[model samples]
Target: MTNNSTCNPLLLGNQLCFPLYASARKIVAAYNPFLKEIGLTYPQYVTMMVLWEEKKITMHDLGKRLYLDSGTLTPVLKKLENMGYVTRSRKPEDERVVIVEITPEGQALREKAEKVPYAMGCLINRKGNLFTPEEVETLKKQLYRLIHALE
Candidate 1:
């Protein structure tokens, strides 16, 4: 067999998205155990993080911040509501709009969740320092740029 790189644009190694996708999956997986300890899944945890910061926001705004669509976000919100971590209600002025708010339970969870970032940072830097803090920041900025470009 002959190797001809030019002949195959479909090759996984030739695509930028493949590595980004793989790395995202791996990072999310790495967060699982830590998230599980707090009784939240990765998506729910991220949602709560935003709610924790904002205290309360419209469902539309929450979805935009998380880059998730209603189809995806609705179930997550529902689960959080069921878990008594959040509440969802229609906006009084606009019945079309929905709002999400964190409960006191959810607020209390923040103390436990506060350690997650430190733990993940330790894991990332554990094996001979996979990336320096500066490198990580640069990579994060670049990824956000890519996301913005795509949007």
Candidate 2:
């Protein structure tokens, strides 16, 4: 067979996913110092955000919202439960259903977390605010479109 790797469309640099993957990792890593101070990993912080908004939600629903599977979420929930940030239990009406609720401690964390986004914003802006607000919105919209299309 003739060699064609030189002009292959599947070359790493030609893929759209590489930049998205790298940027996502960089963005999450940039939040580490702030998240570390609050005693949460990125995944836990996001899970907590959903709990903060909903107060209480079923495990399945929470997983759906977080785009996580129960296998992955179970451990995060356990750690949060152990940390006193959330309480997880079986639903009285449906034993098979697990419900996660934010405790007073988790609510307290919300107050401290209020500054995290602003801190991350400052970090990104310090790196030169590469995208204008409108551009950011456009990028988000486009990404959402791609996500939905993939889904």
lDDT of 2: 0.93
TM-score of each: 0.93, 0.91
Put down candidate 1 lDDT per residue, 1-151, tens digits, no spaces: 2378756788888789999999999999999999999999999999999999999999999999999999999999999999999999998999999989999999999999999999998898888788877998999999999989989
Candidate 1's C-alpha runs over 4 A off are 1-3
User: Candidate 2 lDDT, tens digit per residue, 7-126?
Assistant: 677888767899999999999999999999999999999999999999999999999888889999999999999999999999999899999999999999999999999999898888
What's the lDDT of the predicted structure labeled candidate 1?
0.94
- Flag clash pairs in model 2: none
Question: Residue-pair clashes per candidate, as listed?
Answer: 0, 0
TM-score of 1: 0.93
lDDT score of residue 53 within candidate 2: 99
